[model samples]
Target: MSRGPVDPRLLQLSGPTRRWTAVLAVVTALRTVALVISGIIVGRTSASVITDGTGLADHRAALGVLALLVVARTALAWVEQRYSHRAAAQATEDLRVRALTVLAHRDPRTVDRAEWRTLLTEGTEGLGPYLTGYLPALMSTALATPAVLLVVWFLDAGSAIVAVVTLPLIPVFMWLVGTLTAGRTEKKLMTLGVLSDQLLDLVTGLPTLRALGRLSAPVAEVRRLSDRHRRSTVEVLRIAFLSSMVLEFLATLSIALVAVGIGFRLLDGSMTLAAGLTVLIIIPEVYNPVRQVGTRFHDARDGIVAVDRILTLLTARSDGDTTAHPGTTGEAGGRVSEERDAQDGQGGQGLTVTFDHLSATGRDGPRPRDVTGTARPGQLTVLTGPNGAGKTTALLALLGIATDGVTGTARVTAGPGTGPRLTGTELWDRTSYLPQRPVLDTADATAVGDTSGLSLGQRQRAAVHAELDRSRTTGRDLLLLDEPTAHLDTPNARTMVEALRRRAAEGATVLIASHDPLVTAAADHHIEVRP
Candidate 1:
């Protein structure tokens, strides 16, 4: 599906963010108040001295007072940024956590590795402006612009009238300019996404590409994407420069017109010099808010686009199947409050994972071959298959990660009186899947497994063992491995196999997917898939 327009629904989706936005609203209001008050004081003092033609009776006093207020304004600005950044970081964290939880439960077949990486890594980071900058900007526009105009109206009705009437023209021009490049902006963002995906693939496959003498092509592609990004940025800046010129011209002209009228009024003895000068000075101050809004509008536009993607990811549906068994939450945290009912007892059942008649097709390829498998307690079932023979797909189906293209039902069954069988996340608690290419979040290195002095193989084994330990402690009872030996040498693979079998002997169901005969030979049950 094509990327759709940014919907206000992003702001509406998160209750916590909306509530906190009220806090930002207060901050923005204060910002507006400070801006308007400071502007008025500056305008009034400058006009008073200019119109009165007075020298320094108390110039030092006035300068010192204005300096103090300026210092206060700067302090307020600092505070606003401090709190806004804190709030933005919190909002980003909340959205990222929720998105990741949803992603963990999603069927991997539907959301590929590239998409997940972009959404998780880039999408969350891109949403900074919405909470910290744009939200406050919109708030200030709504709160301060009108009040500033009212002050201008009180200072001089004629200038105020013109300022108020012409102020909306700034937003209108901004929208017009922004619209002219909206398509280009979106196209650029998409290009960046693809570039990001390509760079990630290249980095991950760098060793293989170098071995095969294929590194130059990826390097060329990176250079091309970078050049395109540079051009897009240049185009955006050109538009920005033109838009800024328009705002400046309009603001200057509007203020000048007010000054001319006030000049005529003062010469005609229709108003005091002080009052006419005050009105003249306030003219520019009135349009200042509108001018700021126009500039910040672009940031808000990008923020909306980023937030649209974030909300889409968060709200997408996923099949809610977990492998946790009945008579308990089947959750990893072990908050189950009740013992299994007598009828729920699954004597020696341990766990039974069955994938029945599953099939999937890839991008522009033949329909996926049918795959079937089962894993039972006290037994090690190894699935041996060539590349693309559906071994990984089958494992994912059993793990509930390939639900998108799964044509038939898969179920995890427990013996009688073990409560109803668990599947999905419940099953997840009872199982640990070590993918062929594991993507571990390094943010919590200690939580996944200790990494000190460990080689790649040791790290992988430690992660697997850590999951096993965590499961056993949390009342989980199954483990699944995809290509457990793919990246390891013969010796390390053999060692891991022995460790895996020992876990099986301890009543954990272990299922291994591999192309190596060594892994299959050690298995209590072996299922081979032929292309």
Candidate 2:
């Protein structure tokens, strides 16, 4: 799977935003025209005032036109600012949605939650400068630069020539600075991601750290990481400042040269005062867009890098095979078999899950390998395994939750002709899953009897009870519980298992991954997974 180029991918995702940006560009061009007209009126009026004692009353019409143009320019500038921000916001929203969709579909273990939070929040928002500042300036340069150059040319060809020749120098200097700082910018972004991850990890595990008497242990480590990130940020900023300095210097030098040429031509009586003044006024406008691009480039770099990361994730395929059938394990480009198996019965009382050559690879550890099993409805199927044996992975794979590094055939044999295999949507619709470490929101915390006041075990038990109640009301077809009894005491754990058993008796397919002897003892079918 090819990720392709970032700009095209962004454009494809944000069609409406691009249209808005184009509209913004047109408004910007109009604003530039107003500025040029105002400059021309000012130049001609000044020349008139100098040439004739009665020029003030004689040039009253031009002064009025200048005033109106100023008002129009101000109004256009306001609209441009508003529309540019709106466009940037809309584009960022699109990127966030796409990135989130990819995250939701991919295997959870493969994703770094903290980094994802940073990417979706701070990283996506970083695009504001790119869209609102950089893109607008780029479009303005494309539209305004040439128009201004032509106006200057008509007034004085020599000044126009100097403007044209020097305009390219700003972009050239920008390119040089960008080339030199690209690596540092990337490193700075990476450091930020790491810092975000570490801070999030520390916050999430604060309770555990406190309980283990190591609450303050990570403080020094965090400080060190923070300092490193600070240094990286400063380095990137320093480069940005240097780039801006170079662009400003080049633009200023070019404008000064044009000013000098126009002054000399005026002194030699080769150019009219009005024409010289107009060329002098418009020269700086020619270089303004290019210089703006260089300044905004600093802010846009992070967003660009984030887009690349997002594209990489979007293009990645699951480990099994890209072309394999949804429920089967096969090589890439393999076709889904059309032949129906004998087990492809019509809609029945319950679903039967079958796994053939079931296995999954882990990011940093070993996983279950080649494990074959069947889990029938109306029974408790307990997966017993040592730690890191992929018990949770197996359950997740059956629900199509984490299929990235999984290679297996997991068929949920239910209703109709070829056995209605479960898609991710169907699985989510029919199943109630309880993860080992659930992050509770406000409602969940309240249901769990104020999580802040409860012990971990009490909170877990309350959460389970709440979920069980929901399952009963919704009548979910399947229940996937990972380490359901992990935080509970023996008696509480037994009671929880009994409650689960009741759910299974009510015709829900219940699968649990546990290491507890009590849970395995109550299972209707027990399967042990080995590393």
Candidate 3:
């Protein structure tokens, strides 16, 4: 897929990072100013300790000054942390919402199991560390380091010069390690995705594999993928550990050099005892953020890469067609205006679909073909096809999936004014697909305010009834069902069939695709597939 403009995720990052950086910068500057005041107090107190030696009045005053500075710095640091976390959390939430929106618009059939699994598992999982750990580290390096260095320069020019010269080396080394392992890290991630994909495929298809005596084949392939993933992981870990060690050594050596310099100056009386102790305490503070930056660099790199992959997934071409709003005209093609006008004229009656020469396949193999059909307004027409037939595909094609590459002359009767055809947004507005295995997530169910302990059949029936009730307010009515009696045994299937018949009698178009003999026998209208 060709990428468009800048990634939205990257654009979203800019605002939050700016807010967090500003807050952290203020905190760092305040802390540095406090340190300066504290240093002056320390100097004056030291002089009093030497001259007065045992005056209770002098000791008490010094203690009061020192205590105030400590409390102020502590409070500011706490506020900084609280806001930083809030920024991180909000950014992560935005990314998650954008990801879901992208997924919702995607062509369902175009997404393979591996891609879906990667998005669900690795993609979302990367966001937490990226925001909380990596994002703040990046901001701290760019913001806090400079502020700390400025303070150090004011206090001791020599120490400031050393820090300025050495800090760049840490990032340089970090970049080198990152560059060397870039290819390997990507390869490792790819292998891990493949490993997860293989394992999942095996798990979902286990029953079929056992039935067909092909379990060993998939099991062997899964082992191979797992071993490859394990080897790649080991290589990545080895490089990461070595890089961390090198970075640690360099940063420690840099701080040690500053400490050595201050000690030498203190011995020669070039620096006062108060200044020496302050420099000793402040040197580590200057380098501490930089040290943290190095540690979190790996996480940051991985997260950015993961984000890039997510953007690619999100922006991939969808099977859905472009929508034309009422009374709007521009670039949709010839006869588009007429179609919109037709839909407008027919307020009660919405999109009408006619299928010709439709054929589809499951994951296993190609299904039967030549499914000709039409769905009229205010009429329920149930679709029936044999096992391994293209019934589901025919319905999906009507809804604009499995047929994005084709253009057709299929007419959509939108009220009295006939339109060009139904595709994309037009098809979507008139359609709602219920798959054979309607996924019932506990979370999704709660989200829509449907929280009854209902079985699959009961849940679906209630859901369909609720939709029907809502549609009754408007004059448009239609419902599509795939294997409505899939989970029901013989007796229950009969009851559901009678219920569907009643819905059809109430003037709602209910299309059902089922392989059960009971469903085929009970359907008011049937389209059979012969192999």
lDDT per residue, candidate 2, 145-246, as tens digits? 888888998999999888878888887788788777777876776677888888888998998999999998999988988898889888888989888888
Model 2 residue pairs with clashes: none
List where candidate 3 sits over 4 angstroms from the true fold.
1-8, 11-65, 76-90, 206-221, 266-273, 300-302, 312-339, 343-345, 356-372, 378-394, 401-403, 409-411, 416-430, 440-476, 513-531
**Per-model TM-score versus the true fold:** 0.82, 0.86, 0.76
For model 2, the run of ten residues with the poorest summed lDDT: 329-338
Clashing pairs in 3: 321-424
Candidate 1 lDDT by residue in tens digits, 182-255: 76666656667778888877888999989998878777779999899778867876887788799888888887
* lDDT ranking from best candidate downward: 2, 1, 3
On TM-score, the stronger of 2 and 3 is 2
Residue 227 C-alpha lDDT in model 1: 92
Tens-digit lDDT track of model 3 for 86-179: 8766655665576655554433555565654564466455555655666556555666667667767777788888888887888888778877
